[model samples]
Target: MSCQEPEFVTAEDVGGFDDLWSSYGFYNEGCFEKGAPLVLNDQQLFSDFAFMDDMHFDSISSAISVAAETDQPASNSELLQLDEKSTPPLPSKTSELLSKYQFKFNARSGEKPNESIERGGSKLSTEDFMRIAASFFIQLSTHKDCNPFMLNNQFGLSFSGLSSAEIMNVELAILLFSAAEKVSQQRFDHGTNLIKECYKLCSKTGNSVQRVVYYFADALQERIHGGKGTVVKAQEVMKALLSNHPVHLATFRSLPLEQIMQFTSVQTILDNLGSAKKIHLIDLSIKHGLQWTILMQALSNSSSVDYVKISAVGTSEEEITSTGKRLTSFAEILKLPFVFKPVIVSDIKELKEDMFKIEETETIALYSSMDMNTMIIKPDRLENVMKVIRNLRPQIVTVVDVEAKHNSRSFINRFTEALFYFSAFFDCLENCMRGDERVRMIVEEDFFSPGISSIVAAEGSERVIRQVGIDVWRLFFARYGLVEAELNQWSVYQASLLVKHFACGESYSFEVNGKALLVGWKGTPLHFISAWKFQ
Candidate 1:
């Protein structure tokens, strides 16, 4: 096919790749100027879908409103505009309620109320103080083997001081954590009891916290019954795949996580490729070939890109073929010289270098997102895969995976890590999809629930959700003679800008550790994206 002339358009005119960022005012003449501090339009910082409607935020606001009415009536404006620097004492009722829950209020000199609450110090607005107390309750339950009944008593100490929503948060946290603790101890009966109580306290259609807790409770119940509770027939799996595929795609469009990784990977590949005319991408998990659409668009805009080929690797031949066809169609639309090659393998470990059919002229880049971690369950298979990758001599290998340490041998340790990790993730989803509960639940149930089940319910090799931190990944890559490649500042800045455009963006942060970019939520690392080149 003859390629069309490259079209030059402004960032605002570009869709697909640039739509999310540019619409939020991330693109301008001096937006990406080197050494310039990344600044976002304050007005565009919070989207309509942002987390201002968070259940905890609302509950806290309600509780504070009640406190204000009793102590000294304060207007809604006064409540919101409270001085962050001042350490205003909480109402006597709120203080007693916190004290009963074993949460102390120690306001530090000149510290923000939120920061103080995070550090176990407080003189927070009644809202922030209650939110912190709920978090403390979860932490205390998870980290310590406290009696659930006692915790429940503490929660019941002064419901008059709390709104109905606040009471539900307390009840759900205690029940969910208590149930998780029992499951970890192998006390299946006890776990079942607490999970039942959790079910009664929360609903799948309820608030964000309720929905997340409900799912976790379901996973705990499955754990008690041993491994999914029943065998999943192939027909059932296929049926689920068919039903959930649309929701999955919608999630990709709605959430920034997947796009952030893909954008970074594509940028890394383009940076390394320079003016190479022949490009080959070996996708470890091609799925729907969504990431490559961005690459193809960029390549179509570049005169240097003469030929493009993708060897999509996946387990299902049908799915891979479908992805190849879709990409081929997209490539034709761009009038780009493109070839879609499907490399089907029964298992990722079965991958052979010859399967890729690499040509000497082709500049190759390998992209793996949440795929290699599955192979870690069998070290030999993973090492063999790495060996094949090393021998292929790809110009750059991009990796994006969960930044959690869930590969621990101890069940309790792994459970604790997974609980906190998924909690943050679900909380993030709640913020990102505040008004759109249906899509949010679909993503949670279809995409996230299985991973949670595998981590909590399965054992040994059956547990395929083995995610490790970047530190572990660095060590593993080093053993394979791969050196980390530094991600450019432009990519990091774009990622930061992308995150700040969402609700609760202040809670989301980006940190650079050596050669990797870590995406964190509320100070806890959730995922990392990095690039590596063979030494």
Candidate 2:
């Protein structure tokens, strides 16, 4: 057929190689000279629909049809954003609540209160400190035994606990710096006014914290303006800011709650199966069993499947204990005879040998919510993981993780949800009053950085140190010729939506004013299937 001639293709078609080529350059360059509508081939009709219903895209089928009629395929990049217009309106209740908090706290003028938290007064009473300390100690003491499920329910550091004045000092400075960087239009000068104000309030001997803040704001301004000597300036500033600081890089070594949430997000995308066998969850870091606790609960409640065995892997022993305990408990609750094994390797070469120890079976479902993202960031680590999973060839590898896009570029609908929900949780903690109102104070004053609040509000856990979930899953499946599974479960859908929401914010805007496409802070739910059948 002539390039311009109408041709038939399956409506179920993801752009074919030819369409991809044309979409990239040829078609846009006038390769298709005809105005005639393409009679695209269609896939088998849905069982109930006699017509070729299965061939169609559900939400954006109309847009796709237009592209097809023009002898050009819709670009994948644009297709990803098609849903931008379809975001459901946010609930009025949610909007009002967020607005109230935003006005109350974000609008506050002058320096934030003496949140400097000194010991004395009923506001800073010993009883209050003891309560906070007790909760903090429990988390530290149970680090090896605490999983996300347990910790999530308790009052502990959602990301990292802040108790020592030294840790808090460094953390607060960083938070201010990051916040200043984000809000500043010039990237460098936005927080200068604030810093200068802080200086005036400082003690005469030159408070290092205030100095560090001033230096950081100066360095940030330099970096944004493309001024010379940015790196050296930043380094110097960092040295000064962190110098003599109590908490070292070692204190910030492990992943945060935000990271762990990515792994659990995979569960939200899973098909609510009534029954199944072994399930394999993969990830680079699995400390304190946070993600596993969530997974165990998901499995126990899954309507579609029942799991008898679970194979989980972590980068180290320190990350495995809590996950292991949670998994064991989950199995016990369900009264299912289960074996939870941790895949470990002292060396990369050993991983291959140890990986083979798991039985190759058809009934297994491989769930790697955290693995894929870490692999994307560190492809080398994924090579062995991909090979092992490919060999075992589990029924499904459901990936749940944070999308790699920065918060600014995330899908708007999910982003809104995330902003609203996260703000609610954060406000709950930050708005803690002194005395009986400690919780609000903790949220507001304790975790000031977007990073910390972000982790605590949504993703606080060990899940943060790995690769992006989507990229890792895509590559892993493609390497083994696996197909992207359909999401057939509601929980999986919720998980996806939750993640999308987590990444969004008020800065997001749609093409129109009132029709704002607020982020839902959730994502599309998915169900996965295998191209090849299990044994």
Top candidate, metric TM-score: 1
lDDT of 1 by residue, 373-447 (tens): 665555555755776887798999999887876665556545555666777777677767777788987767766
So what's the TM-score on candidate 1? Answer: 0.69
Candidate 1 Cα outliers beyond 4 Å, as residue runs:
1-164, 228-244, 500-507
Query: Candidate 2 lDDT, tens digit per residue, 360-446?
Result: 542555554333433322334445565565556655555444432212211121122232333333322222212323333322232
* Model 2 per-residue lDDT at 199: 41
TM-score of each candidate structure, all chains considered together = 0.69, 0.39
The local distance difference test score of each candidate is 0.61, 0.33
